[model samples]
Target: MGPIRPTIADVARAAGVSRTTVSHALNGIGKVDPRTRERVVQAAAELGYRPSLRAQRLRSGQSRTIGLVSSMPVAVAGGPSKLGFFMEVAAAAAETAMLSGFALVVVPPLDTDPPLDALDIDGAIVIEPDQDDPTTKRLQSRGVPIVTIGPQQGMDLPHVDLRAPRVGRLLLEHLREQGARRIALLMGSGHRSWYVDLAEVYARFAREHDMPPLVVEADESGGEETGREACAELLEKHPDVDAICAAVDAFALGAVRAVAERGLRIPDDVRVATRYDGVRARTSTPTLTAVDLNLAQAAASAVELLLANLKGTEVPQVISNPDPRLVVRESTRRG
Candidate 1:
């Protein structure tokens, strides 16, 4: 046979203390004198007393951990801008997990094939997963519960859809509220679907309210220069445009620069807003007004959904629709 496992009673006896004191010292609960706690720890160490994580998990019926995967495309400041948003998601998920007696393990995309067999997570949350991604398909096949952040194209995956069109509507409503009539839309390339939906929503809102459609397409050349050129061209093309709703924050910043170059003041000549609430928006010269999607809350909810599935809790095909809150700031409040 193997060596017998030491127990808390063994530790207490070795430390010449009651079991309650030993328990208190080990769990950091209630009160135990400092020296006594230290002595208990020393005794436990001497006795090779190891707390049984497995036993604890069995008793609690929880793995006490979550796995997080970010399938975000690796592009230099691309449409997703994974760093800030994904980090917020992970951090908030970790905090919520810890509160509910769990931990978070962030797994970046594997260079080789993803090995589901090697992963021992209770559940997972996939951020910005592509619909046709094989890794995601494999994970789902393994009965590992998952929640996706952005919209998935074809797969029947549970997700919290970030309504891109609503983002446009929010900005339109804000601009309208601020008495903006002529609005211009700044769109990025490759994400044609998102911008198209946004344009559709903007047009519907404008037509319903009897306003002119100001849609301008910007080529995403993966550089600030292209964004600057696009902004300048659009501004020159429509000097009387009172507001701009950009698809992303960086492009919005570029628009701000273009507006300033024309010797026109922000909000006075051109108000601007974007869908993302990020550092670029916050640090812009006139602090852009954006729709705060509350990514943290969304992440937490996704994780909870994953955990529910992991627990065999009849995971409902839930669709989380987080409303976008318009963060009113200097950029768009006056126009």
Candidate 2:
């Protein structure tokens, strides 16, 4: 059987305080004596008392929770690659918000119905905004303070752009430092703003630096197989290509596997680097070298931006831009 739910009266009796004092202490409402409040809190903690979120919402008419709506899949079935980028961003956002006395409730897809009907969130942070994404528009219409993690075309709202071009330059500079004159880019295929920005950056950088602009399509054969095929093809075409820079870490992992299968040494045979350093980068055989996009920072910035908007506070035109720092691992280091 489950443990009994403790009530406000129980806490009040235990603390020798009035039920009203216990209520005010637990909910963080108007003036209650600090000493009494602390005693009440101790009693509640000892009893493992969980305040009813629904009753609190009804009484205060404001939910203390923020919502996160993701457009990416959260899990994969028996696949080497794990959840997509948005999951990481959501987790980071939740962590920061909870630390600041806010609760984060992640809303999964309804598929048939819109998610708005089911939630009473104070504000929302939408991850990876597309040009035609309706969720942003709908939320804006409802006067919900919404922030986007990725690019949102023509929207005059605060956002965080990952600055993909700068990321490409970082990779190129690393390769150049490792004595690799010939380099290729393995990038995501879909025409999302992030990938588009990455391609433009790779092309512009490669030309200015006089490096070969070899591009590989990120096919949907899953990240591993796609990496194997693309890496093999690039190596065969440009045997002199000493480095491969991938925008997605999943693809980078694929490239690493391909390099291993070819009986080639990393950095010496063909150096590999990527963006989106998550589980795969940390756990890969050689430990991938990647640009840590600072997803947690992005999440905090996005939430604070929305909170400012909700409070009628003047917010800057942009909340956060990608300040990517490169994480060097064995994948790009030469022995």
Best candidate (score: TM-score): 2
Residue 227 in candidate 2, Cα distance off native in Å:
3.2
**What's the lDDT for all of these models?**
0.75, 0.76
> What are the per-residue Cα lDDT tens digits for candidate 2 across 81-181?
43446667777888877877778887654334356756777788877655666777877787677877776766766777777678777877888798878
lDDT of 2 at 316: 84
Per-model TM-score on C-alpha atoms: 0.69, 0.74
Candidate no. 1 TM-score:
0.69
Candidate 2 lDDT (Cα, 0 to 1): 0.76
Give candidate 2 misplaced runs (Cα > 4 Å). Answer: 1-61, 74-87, 107-117, 132-143
Clashing pairs in 1: none
